[model samples]
Target: MAAEAIDRAMGALIGGALGDALGMPTQLLSPTRIAELYGHVEDFVAPSADHPVSKGLPAGAITDDTEQALLLGRILVSSGDRFDHARWVNALLDWERDVKARGSYDLLGPSTKRAIDAINDGVPPEQAGSSGDTNGAAMRIAPVGIMMPPEPLDALVAKAAEACRATHNTSIAIASAAAVAAAVSSGVAGSDWRVASDRAVAAARRGATLGHWVTGGDIAARIAWAQKLVRGKAEKEAIRLIVDLIGTGVASQESVPAAFAVLEVAQGDAWRAAVISANLGGDTDTIGAIAAGMAGACSGLSCLPQGRIARLKGIDLAEVRALAADLVAARNAKAGSGKEAAA
Candidate 1:
């Protein structure tokens, strides 16, 4: 159990990195083009921006998936073992808000990048996120599940939804963020994929506001539908359906559904999931990153390779370390508070 716990945690981080780096080269490839270019991006290579790694990343480097997740991890440490929404939001805001020191170019999704740009221009933070519906929130949300306080799953889901407002605020985006966070947390708690999936869907359902663009039903149903659509269909056809049926790219509609669909495809194979995620075309890196993180959280770290971790860029490494340290600190604080989840 201990080993499994560790591995699941490792899965989230390593899987995220693998997906991000692999998709970097083909960030904008159409599903058909992706299949033609590579059956699936299986290895770590620095794809030129036009190629895949083009999201302003270095060879063998990941994107905001690792960076933002690390930020959440660091805040969890400061959270004293439980969530403090303000602190979490502030942490994310600080990192992305101070754009003078930009993270890797093209690292942040358009919604988040635009929202931050709005905040810098004097828009209130709350209003800043109103327009963002990109996958930015979903892509970097894994750490919240990894180390959140153990308690009411519903409340945690709400928190996750609200927490994503630093960048994303649309109901669909918020729900997607909650799903990823809840799924990761369920994996941490040793639940199976179905349990995790149920919790994730339930969380999204709860967080959804009336008249929200994407229904909980839409997100959940699409997973099954994408699988059926891809059956005997060419890989390109599968990718197209993901774009047409589920969406690809950064829109919350595209990101969350695409990630879930690709996740279903990856099933239990860490490498296969990550590779296919990138190959599904639109927002390939983001989809791959989210699925990969979920895979890591559900599986164990042993399923991933150490070489990939070593190959990630130095900046990303430092960010993840900070997040991990925060996770440990959060546990310690919870212990001191007499309510640590570990107890």
Candidate 2:
């Protein structure tokens, strides 16, 4: 209720899980199909016939969204700013071996795979992630925000870009991942949604080689047009239009822009906004998670439904809360000692 930074991290993780499970049932449901069936689901929806992958995997169990995020959290906790890339690759391999369906090492992007391979061949961790622009980077980036809080988010975002380069190094991918990471960090650090959005956009603008015309203005236009289409229309329809008009992929432009549209438009609301994002059909879980995480980060834990809180998996709420607390503690310790160097 206090809207603390740790609270924001917890809320974002919970919201990300909720969005994944809530959308899992209707993951591929088209806007038109969703309208014909249950409209505007504010709760978990049962899996239907013709849905793709894990059609009956029980409601409330999060997919790769939470799993990958938690893995990243674990990495940060173990390594701090000196993240070991090769070690992370081994950890990922182990996680995949245990495969709870959250994510898989085999599901990695080309850039990440290349980076890890290079690291195994003796490439440095600092240079390992310099070649990726995949959503793979942004997908697991929220934990970084929780790990480093109450600072100018841009600094943390740069680190996120470095981490992502283990798989994607394109400027667009770097910029997009940086935006999501910055938004989460800013949100946890007690910034408003507008301010978080502004901070995120600023970070993206400054870090990206693309100018406003290529990145900012275009993204704003895409979201604005989507808002008009979805206005007064059911949320499902809006999702289809956005996905149809803009595509969803691991690529920075495709996935990042679509995710950004939902965040930019649905700033103050996380649940209603997640529904809009989930209905996009393709990459529903990741899209919903990204939008929900961004919004949840800004809105703080108070914005999440208690019903969702009762249904977390993989790790307990207590552990998650502790991780959140540790981030603030780490931040305070570093700030107090003047050791809060850039990552």
Candidate 3:
């Protein structure tokens, strides 16, 4: 059971990076543009020369989605069960500096950049993220899910909220992050994909009551609607419906639900989910990362293509595996103690 937990944890981490790398070249492009330029993102492909954020990045390089996730994972493992908001903010700032120094245009997302700027200008960390409603929180929340358990779901939602407090404290943002985190947690606990998706919706509902309220579509409702919308549709048709109606932008309402929709279309196949999300256009890397993370968590590392996994570059897989092991150990410790773990 310990080994299986570690495998799923590693799957969540590696699947997120794989999806991020696969979507690096397609992010920010329109579906038509992706179709015209790359046909369909079946594997890692270098970003087009004029690509705004990821231009000049190599084929198998991960973007901020995976980088920030790994950063959060490291923090979770080292900090034990407590989530340090200041440490998270400082880490993000340091990460952005590194990204700039590397000459990569893929810097911080809007929500994170805004919150960090506000923090620098003397705004409280909790207040700084009150207006953020993007998918930044959800995109990087896989680590929280990995370290936390799914039952006593209120605890899971609260942990997710704490993780989002530094940069994405809006109701929509918290709910979105909680949804993804719950799905990942459920998957790590060996739940099936459908059960995980149901938990995601439940968590989203609970999470929506916390954080500053913002005007947006309900994340939980949209996730349910998205799954139903794509149930019996062909892959191409499902992708088109998700792109046109469900949307594929940075909004938590759009991207988070869109990810679940993609997961449904792929039937929880990690590699296929990543490929579909890569060709999904608009916030592709984030959508891919979220979808693939949940899928991998449900299906484990075995669901991934080993050849493509071997081709991945830049990110440290050994460290990811270590973090997974640590997180699983932490979970086990909490379970053995029969006590609630701190977030």
Using lDDT, give the best candidate's number: 3
**What is the TM-score of candidate 1?**
0.81
Q: How well does model 3 score by local distance difference test?
A: 0.91
lDDT for each residue of candidate 1 in 6-28, tens digit (9 for 90 to 100): 55776777778787877777777
For all candidates, the clash counts are 14, 14, 0
Q: Score residue 287 of candidate 2 by CA lDDT.
A: 76
lDDT score at residue 330, model 1, on the 0-100 scale = 50
lDDT of each: 0.66, 0.65, 0.91
> Which is better, 2 or 3, measured by lDDT?
3
Q: Estimate each model's TM-score.
A: 0.81, 0.81, 0.97
Per-residue lDDT of model 3, residues 15-76, tens digit only: 99888889889999999999999998798899888888888888998989999999988887
